[model samples]
Target: MVSEERRVTLREVARVAGVSVSAVSYALRGAANIPAETAARVRAVADKLGYRPNARVGELMAHIRQARPLAKAEPLALVYLEGDRATAKKNGFAQIVEASARLHAAHRGYRLDAFWLSEVEGNARRLAGILTARGISGVLFAPTVGEKRIELDWPWADFAVAVAGMSELSVALPRAGHHHYEAMREVLRRMSAKGARRPAAMIEATTNERAHRGWQAAWLAYGPAGAARRLWLYRAGEKNELAAWLQRLKPDALVTDNANLIHAAQAAGWAEPNERGAVLSWHARSAFGGIDQGYDDIAAHAVDLVVTQLQRNERGLPDPPPMLLFPGRWRECSQTSAGGHAPSLREAMRCAL
Candidate 1:
């Protein structure tokens, strides 16, 4: 306890850098108003002086920012595929999740500015140039509807990046997405517990592969005995198999992401009105209930991951890239009805066992 070193202050760094405290501030944050070269030099000097930002002050600023106008927020990059449906489909899951990310980022004093890959013709070099010119340090890769892998040669070392949504990225970095495996297992378990003796999971092959076979694996691990044959993995336009499969299983319950297939079975007199079934995705929800895989929450976490990286001055692909997964929320039939009020995805299951 003989001696204690004093923490470096912004005032001290500013004085040594031959600039005002405001310049120092902008430079440290890599704010676009300041030149990139100036920002780089200032950061280097701060590093040499052993400067550290106070977390409490940052937390307070973030709280204050909550009350600020959208125009005042700093800009962050939102990278998405060109023509990748923001509207996505009739359900609009892609649109809703992206909008949530924008709102949450705004709450943190950051504005998510969209940049489609089409802008630069999928050229990562040109994309990086645009981002650098704008002084954007944080980047979020938006979700895709059907695309699984990205094919860009991006320079990850210069930016704090995170990807979000239902698809997986080819380039590894931090990501936030739905916990597909846990969700599938939970749904199957609930179906079994709710008096489903011969429940079957009818999933499409592409959807199953995209989720890394989480749906298939869950059915295999926990489905009813001899139910594997009942688990028909079909493709689009081959849904007619439902009638034959239904005849074979005569299942009293079902676990599926296909509302169209369910409707076909019901209309064909295979599925009874009282038959119980769990819809796998909210996007696929019909009059029957389903799981709401918190897309908004996943989007928020992606933005948060990018913000945290920027705060720590961390860039490049993280080692073993971290992934944050959120589980699904069960929705009841009432919530799926016309003019029905849907609750927040963050809430726990409100129906089934």
Candidate 2:
């Protein structure tokens, strides 16, 4: 009868081949330093002995390689399409997102480089050449303000790309952004809990379009039983119709993206949050209570997503681009009394009257 044998091992193969363990390892991994004849002989020995590589060991080795700090990697491009510096600054969220992405990329042993679309004179081919020359294989498209659509004529098939917001570019790419619809829902819920009978939404048409109409959709969905939900649209440099809408709807609480809505309501002879509740959907300052969009988190995730594409060798627009949304945090900006307790809206209303 044939004798039973255990699995072949690399150590036994090395011993039989009269080579050091390191030599055996290098030879097996096809290191160039090993003599071709020696490598071939060792491989033959391994094959004869049925010395198969251990999957778990391979996985651990891969993990070790990844854990080792890389000296350098190709820089990632943060493409900004805003027309000018002032426009970029005015879109405060874009600045925050770019800063967050830069920090996160550094943590991953990579550099983030900013590329302003305006600098390239709106030439996509020139942008592509610049990126190629810099060896940048990954891109993070920053959120674009206004109604301008980004049309890139670059060789997109060669680079991994992702967008911070859906409105950033016309091309379909993986996106990371705040959960606008859910945030609207959350605001409505909080208002309801505060005994607000009627809640309405007023959004700038451009802002609404940029957010993919999420605010309007959420408001329409949250209409209470037997109540007609109202959504007011505001166009830039257009006549102010919000006052008329307020007079007609008489909504107890109003949710809006524009902070100026408070002034508009006041001009309409209604005290904000005191006579009628007001919630700023996009809160840029601590003085106004609204949803914190968590821009930093969104930007970090966007970097990660783009890096993942680079690692996987994925390029161009994704078929059915995936969207990642982060939830917004609610902030209460109600006025506080000397005792540090928030004054009731009713109390403020009485004071205003």
Candidate 3:
């Protein structure tokens, strides 16, 4: 009698195809993120090796996974790109985002690990090695703090990476952040509705550039006629120039993202926050409310971006890297989140890109 033939395993197929087991599985399932060429190659190799699917084993494993408690969670890294870990801990915004990311990672069956690029001597390559050694496959980069460009030559192909902010990094990776354009527009609209005709936008030059000039573009598109001309791209030591420009424009409302704008306006003898239409683009840590950026949501979304890629076994920089932005909620006179619903990420990207 002929003996029962040995069954081929996914590991054998992956070893022969020179791909990962997860990749082989995704390729078999025809996951959208899995490249078609790679999927075809995996299929050809599996066919040659006579690898047959074990439906009974697959179902049993699936059931076991569903019933098992999440005791051994996968490790994920959340790298804060600010100063040192000490500085990050001191930063209120950084602390808030970090806590949110950690909480969301726990909910997603991942144990979030914290790392500071500054603590690692700003050596991104070393950081990469450290993360890989710890068996971390997914990474979430905290949104960079300032307008300065972050130069990182990290080996990005080895893991799934996502960012919590805009295009400040040297390499363009998938990112999620506040929608500067829509937030600016919303602030201006709310101010206009509150009886401010001559509204001028005050922003920093590099800040606007980092925002893709969305602030200026929104001023032109949504504000009163020639409001773009009324914009004051304030820089350091330009308080005198700013005062003169304010005198010339005589704007009824100062819609600004910079906190310093309020102080400058005070020096220029502008009205108080309550008296004039002075509003903020980011409303956190301010009684002078304008837009609630929902930072907790943004941080959670960043984790989602990485987790999605990890589930699909996708690595490397994506083609036409996606930018998911959220339009902030308008907090008007009531000290509550007024109804200002942001569009979906895809819908927002249409206006943003």
Candidate 4:
């Protein structure tokens, strides 16, 4: 009769192969020091004994071996909210978030799934059911717009939860995003350092004031003596208003959130970055000079925060600390000055369009 211990141990195999346990381990791992004949013999014994590394044992050992406690493995969800102008801007941000989350999840052994709240139908219960069935215990809420705030059914407290963007969480959820205020301020500062004075900021009429607060604060903190004009491209209208503003403000540099403003400026023939003009992206990316604010970094951090909370068996927000704001790269629009002949933001933006 065969022994009930159908599973085999490395010790048993090593003993049968007449070798030290370390030698067996080295041979099995294909370390160069092991002789070919000896490695073959140990492998044969291991195979005959059905020796397999015990997954649970290995996991426990890994946890024990870590200087920091290992987080429990869990699956997570990223849910998107819906709103018109707000939702329109979500696409680019969503892509960056998803890309970053996917990369982190792949490395960390966590699973990430994206679900559109709008597509989930009328029953929030159904959304809850799907999560329970999938054993997903964590969530990252992307900026969502709906007729009303999403009513979630699952116990968020039983898992980790996080949100993106500048909007305050309805619940006690932790938030992570690029420091829009600091970034904008820095953009203004850099533009000034690069020779801009009396910089102007242009934005969409519907742009979030809170998200823009950093830029505003930065402006207040480091702006020139006279107030810089705030131009709304959406409201600017087709009568060359952008051009009018450009001529009127005569700003040494410009800051804007609207992609259209840049295009409009280019259309009005203000695209070139000479000694007289510059445009910087604010919490947005363009072919123009400005900050990335590390969208990818924020995405990665969001994934980690969610996973960490889940591992700790944390559910809903209980005043989670804000993540460190990662600064973005600032490239001068005129790359002709750089040692390598790199394309400027204007050329790149035009190419993207």
Top candidate (lDDT): 3
Ranking by TM-score: 1, 3, 2, 4
lDDT of 4 by residue, 1-353 (tens): 12337766677888999999999889976799999999999988876775654433433555565543443445678766543335534667667777778767644446678776566764545765677688776777775422134445656555567776544444556767667666666776777777776667775543435454565666666767665444333443554567877777666666776545655665666644543233434333344565655667777777767765654444555764655565555554442435555456655554222
Tell me the TM-score of each prediction against the true structure: 0.72, 0.71, 0.71, 0.66
Per-residue lDDT of model 3, residues 175-236, tens digit only: 88888888888888788777888878788887888778877888888888787688888777
| Clash number by candidate, in order | 0, 0, 0, 12
Kindly report which residue pairs in candidate 3 clash with one another.
none
Candidate 1 residue lDDT tens string, 14-44: 9888888999988886699998888988888
For candidate 2, lDDT tens digit of each residue in 135-239? Answer: 787888887667557666777777778888656565778989878788888888887887778767777888877787777777778755533347767687653
Ranking by lDDT: 3, 1, 2, 4
Q: Which residue runs of candidate 3 sit more than 4 Å off their true CA positions?
A: 1-73, 272-276, 281-283, 333-353
* Superposition error at 312 for model 3 (Å): 1.4
- For model 4, what is the error of residue 11's alpha carbon versus the real structure, in angstroms, after optimal superposition? 18
Q: The CA-based lDDT of model 4 is what? A: 0.61
Measured by TM-score, how close is model 2 to the native structure? Answer: 0.71
